[model samples]
Target: MRNILTLAGKDFRSLATSPMFCLIAALCSVMWSFTFLRSLILFAENTQATFNPGPSPTLQMTVFLTHISQINLLFVFIVPALTMRLLAEEKKLRTYDLLLTAPITATEIALGKFLGAFGVILILVALSFLYPLATYPIAHFSFPPLLAAYLGVILVASTYVAVGVFASSLTQSVVLSVVMGLVFNLFLWFLSQGAESATGLYMTSVLEQISIGDHFMAFIRGSIRLKSIMFLLSCTGLFVFLTQRVVESSRWR
Candidate 1:
């Protein structure tokens, strides 16, 4: 456990020192903030012009929450890029052997890298809080749904990071890892759409259950369902387990 923690700490420091991390973080933060603020301003302007009153608290909260929820699709792409190098870069540089020679098992090394990547993701998600905070002065602003949306975002992003880590473990090229992660995500998206178009009720239900966008839409609308929470957790666990298995298999080579 101590060795895992130390490894996780090292991974965290390496990510912090990397220019790619800073560049992507800055890009996501700025783009999301700009889009969200634009929506807020447009909402306020429309309300004042049409209703002869300022935006209501409920509406403001809803808009902000929706923006936060919807913007996670961006993180879906960005997280893979962040995690793609977690294992691939280590392998490419031959540092993975040194780590493996230490007290840490393959599972610990894989999981520690995942946790460190997740920590970086958590920080990025937290940075989006500025959107909700901007609505603090409004009368109808409630923090509960915003908190829930943030939770949902973190859950989804964590799952993506785990998936990317698994992809990274499959190959020693960061670019391949990124492409695999994106392809996997895109495939799920297509599955969701195809399931929706199927004729049978059972098929449609199954598709909705697996639809990442469908599950996230509930949280975006300030509604939390047990199914969505379970889906994200399941996805995270599945990918993390796969990553450990992949890393373990490589040890016999």
Candidate 2:
């Protein structure tokens, strides 16, 4: 346990010093900020023009949540960029052997790296709180929906980081890791889309269940479902387990 904490701390510090991490973080911040500002401008225009008596609290919440959902798409790219180098860099520099031979187990190494990367992503997401905070004055502003959306984003981000970490373990080149991660994410995204288009009712229902966007949409509307939480957690665990297996397999190489 102590070794794992030390390794996690070291990984966290290493990621902090990485120029790639800084560049990706800056890009994500800028993109999210721009999206948030645009939404605010549009909301201000809508609110100032007329007193639309028909705009209920539910409608307002829907609009705000949808806008937030759009902004979170940026995480799809940013997460892969952030995690692409975690294990790839270690393998590329042949330092993975040293770490593997140390007191730490593969599970500890994988989990530690995952936690460190996830911590960075959580901080980035937290920094975007200004978006919802700024909207409080303009809208009916229920905290439940906002909280749900943030939770959804964190789950999505954690899942992506796990996938990226597993991808990173598969290759020594950071570029390759990023490409692999993107491809995997893209496949899942496309599967969700394809499922939505299926002809059979039962098939579509299953597809909707598996759709990341579908689950996220529910949260955006401030509806916290246990099923969605379970799905996100399951995805996170699956990928993390896969990453551990990948790391362990490398020991025999």
Compared with the true structure, what per-residue lDDT tens digits does model 1 show for residues 11-96? Answer: 88888678988898788778877787787777777666775456444552546655775567787688888888999999999998
Worst 10 residues of 1 by lDDT: 51-60
Per-residue lDDT for 233 in model 1? 92
- How well is each residue in 91-184 modelled by candidate 2, as lDDT tens digits? 9998998888897888998888888888888777777766677767756555876788788888888888898898999999999999998887
Error of 1 at 238 (Å): 0.3
Per-prediction TM-score, please? Answer: 0.91, 0.90
Q: What is the C-alpha RMSD of each candidate to the true structure, in Å?
A: 2.6, 2.2
Cα-based lDDT at residue 15, candidate 1: 84
